[model samples]
Target: MLHATISGNVVTQSTTATNHSILAFLTSTIGQISPARIRVDNNTVINNSTSGSTRGILVDTPDTSTSPSFDATVTNNSVAIGDSINGVSGLVAQARKASETCTSLSGNTVTFPNGTPSGIQGLRARQADTAVYDLQTSVSCTGTAATVLSCLNPSATTEVLGTINTVSPGTCLLPVTP
Candidate 1:
């Protein structure tokens, strides 16, 4: 009778409650609660529907509990989250993805630690994605390079150009075709 427990959809509507550990309070060494593995996958646990004082899901010890009291392994379970209306538990997904989104509007430039342009373009050129650049895609600088990259080809008309210092960006311009 060691580490005894129960598991299921537990709905606790108890308004006046104390010294109650709903669902589980399993422990080993010195009367502590430790479940070998609490796989709460694809299940929802909503506790204390009557008031906010109670806990929806608590993997914790009682007031008189000692060290190494309550140790649990919970997975894939959404607990304690609730709606604004009744203050009761709600939803499997916590927050909105639309609120976190910022780059929808134009002129918005999200830079990484080293000032990288966001989105697919940013992930494509992380330098660590060398294999993807080499094997998956290649941008050939035509009209100048007879070989792989143009800058190495002295006779190549096309080149990936760089500017000298004091050059105000637009000053280092190249010719365009009609």
Candidate 2:
């Protein structure tokens, strides 16, 4: 799809299998030569499962020779995780090998239940291509959890365009409330 807009929705998932509440992927099949633009905003996502690789929102572009460029914006969404036995994510944007991929995140909130498992990420951005991959975020993003990594596993090609505030231990950057 070239362009899509998804906004103002509430999604709840109760499963033990790997799943994503909101997912968008740009593929190279069917001779998709142009870029893809997707917008996800103002939604509430709830994950009620305690085990699985669950995610609240995910946007991805696969690695292929004829992959199209992608631009996605995710904003003003709320995500709540009941618990996690394995790794889980609130939001993730990944561009494996696209020519150009841009992702922007702003005004999002994520919360995890108390005593949740470790290695839970609130926001994650990854890019693995020689081309440009921009990941931007505003200052209004926030994550609340007891043992969570607010932001995790950002690759070298991912460029974050916002003020980054790091918590203690210096392994993650959580956005400060403004």
User: Candidates' lDDT values, in order?
Assistant: 0.24, 0.60
**Could you give candidate 2's per-residue lDDT for residues 1-178 as a string of tens digits?**
4668778999988766467889887777544555777788899998776666677888876547656676677777887777656547677767665456656565677777554457556666565664455554324333422112233222111123222222322221222222
Q: TM-score of predicted model 2? A: 0.69
Instruction: Name the regions of candidate 1 deviating beyond 4 angstroms.
Output: 4-23, 26-42, 47-50, 80-178
Clashes of each: 9, 0
- Measured with C-alpha atoms, the lDDT of residue 1 in candidate 2 is 41
For candidate 2, give the lDDT of residue 5: 77
lDDT of 1 by residue, 84-141 (tens): 2223212110101111100000011111222221221210101111111110111332
Error of 1 at 100 (Å): 36
Off by over 4 Å in 2: 30-32, 129-131, 137-178
